[model samples]
Target: MPSALLPIIAWDYQFAPNAQKSRNYLYITHTPFKICEQPFLLPRPALLSLGITYRRVPVLSIGKDVFCDNASFLDAMQELLEREGEGRALKRGGADRAFEAWGYRSFWVALASVPAGLVSKELGEDRRELFRRF
Candidate 1:
């Protein structure tokens, strides 16, 4: 008999491309999952409740396990698919790495290009506080 599949939850901010990337990956891989969008401010209650200290979007929650960071989340998703005999979804090669690098660079560039007037002062402060270490 086959084992039961657990629910997969993706936590991220609305309009986040990284979140969309995860969703698109799941869709392409034919994996069923749900998304939970977080508010664009500090004190993400849901993440805090999940014991997640990382201040970033695109967190994956599979059953009781929480995966933070894109690399780990993709790795976990790939492993899950493999265990279910779905095969690897991501190609491991120089092209894949280049694409990932481009994606990340573009994401930052897009974010930085957002007009200051379009962002609220509170949101700006929250983002600064979140990424102060970096």
Candidate 2:
């Protein structure tokens, strides 16, 4: 079994959706994982140590395999669940395909239309700076 560590920040509009989705999947499947609430506005050196240069939230660490984005995280989770037989339920509801589309394809496409100025306005200085850099 692999361990997933999710860094959750409750107030982040951009991040909360994916984090909540991941958390829900874990709870429904009864996957044992750790959730740590951290400041999204600050520099996360721990993620950097894991070779995640983007320094974003919703990172899933399975041993040495670190998934940095929602798409990768969900993809890996689906693979793991398939091996555990829980994936059948996901397939039955079309959740497996749905989430993959939402996380990997649709999310970014939708987010692309969101004004960067609006996002910058919502973010604190530290996060705004980091977002610009990334």
lDDT of each candidate versus the true structure? 0.74, 0.58
Positional deviation of 36 in candidate 1, in angstroms? 2.5
For model 1, residues 45-81, the per-residue Cα lDDT tens digits are 9888867878888888777778777777777877777
lDDT of 1 at 115: 71
Spell out the clash pairs found in candidate 2.
none
Q: Give the winner by lDDT.
A: 1
In candidate 1, position 27 carries an lDDT of 81
Model 1 bad stretches (over 4 Å): 1-4, 87-92, 130-134
Superposing all C-alpha atoms, what RMSD in Å does each candidate have to the true structure?
A: 3.1, 5.8
Q: What stretches of model 2 exceed 4 Å from their correct place?
A: 1-15, 86-89, 92-124, 127-134
Residue-by-residue lDDT tens digits, candidate 2, 80-132: 66876645325546575676675657765675576666666446465655434
TM-score per candidate: 0.80, 0.58
**Collision pairs in model 1:** none
